[model samples]
Target: MFYRIHQFWQAIHPIITEDELAWVISLLPAPSLALFQGQPLPEQRHALDVAQDLWSSGIRDSHLLIAALLHDCGKTRYPLQLWERVAIVLLQKAPRKIWHTLSRSSLPLAASLQAAEAHPLWGAEMASHLGLDPRIVELIREHHTPHSQEGYLLYQADNRH
Candidate 1:
């Protein structure tokens, strides 16, 4: 709950230093950087924190860093407003069947929720289309249900944000 509140604060006052932006730029290729830049400021801030968390934890794997930075790129596909994002979090507490059902709903905000729910897959596809490393794509795809140690670590960092 506290984390969600913090996320709300972040959403309102998303701040990233020029140096931090520079750091992210240095880490990504042109295509990947464009994808990162396409995210909302709040999402960009969250991604930076997630990537920084991985770096500070002694994980120097390039793919891990990249995946951490891009995990939410798919969120840009059907972007949500602040209220919608909050509602999505609340909606997530329900069963998977419920979420799946909601995703199928044609009601307003349902598409946004569905997009948020499926960002992992979409981000992975984006990464693959961008010709990024397979490791990075896999990490983004499985951050929600990790299939590798690195992916698990990425998921951990993302959850912290």
Candidate 2:
């Protein structure tokens, strides 16, 4: 609960340091950098924190590192307000079918929920379109389900952020 509050506050007030920008530039290609920068500031900060967490833990696998940085880029496709973000998390308690149905609806809130739930798929597709490595694409795609070791590591790092 404390963490949720902290995240909410951070989402409402995000900061991106010059050091973080340098770190991103050092790691990402120009295309990926653009994609990363296109995200809401909070999401960009979250991605940097997730990637930094993985790198600090000595997980030098490039794909995992990159995936950690870009895992939530899909949120760019359907930018959510802070309230919408909160509602999506709360609504996760709904049945899977209902969630899917809501996501498919034409309503704005439903699309926001879809963006929240399906970001991994959307991010993976974006990565693939950018010619990212298969491993990186897979890591982004399976961030929630985590089929492999790197995927789990990415998932863990994302949560830590």
Instruction: Report the number of the highest-lDDT candidate.
Output: 1
- List per-candidate RMSD values in Å: 1.5, 2.0
Tell me the tens digit of each residue's lDDT in model 1 across 1-161.
Answer: 78888888998999999999999998998899999999999999999999999999998888899899999998877788888888887887889888888778887877887778698999999999999999889999998899888888987888888
> Which 10-residue window of candidate 2 scores lowest in summed lDDT?
85-94
- lDDT by residue for model 2 over 16-133, one digit each (tens)? 8898899888888778888898899999888988999998999887778788889999888878888898888767777888778887888778878867778899999999999998
Error (Å) of candidate 2 at residue 85 is 0.7
lDDT of 1 at 143: 89
**Candidate lDDT (C-alpha), each:** 0.89, 0.85
User: What's model 1's lDDT at 71?
Assistant: 93
Error of 2 at 90 (Å): 2.5
Compared with the true structure, model 1 gives a TM-score of: 0.92
**Which residue pairs overlap in candidate 1's backbone?**
none
Q: Work out candidate 1's RMSD over C-alphas.
A: 1.5
Clashing residue pairs found in predicted model 2: none
How does residue 88 of candidate 1 score in lDDT?
83
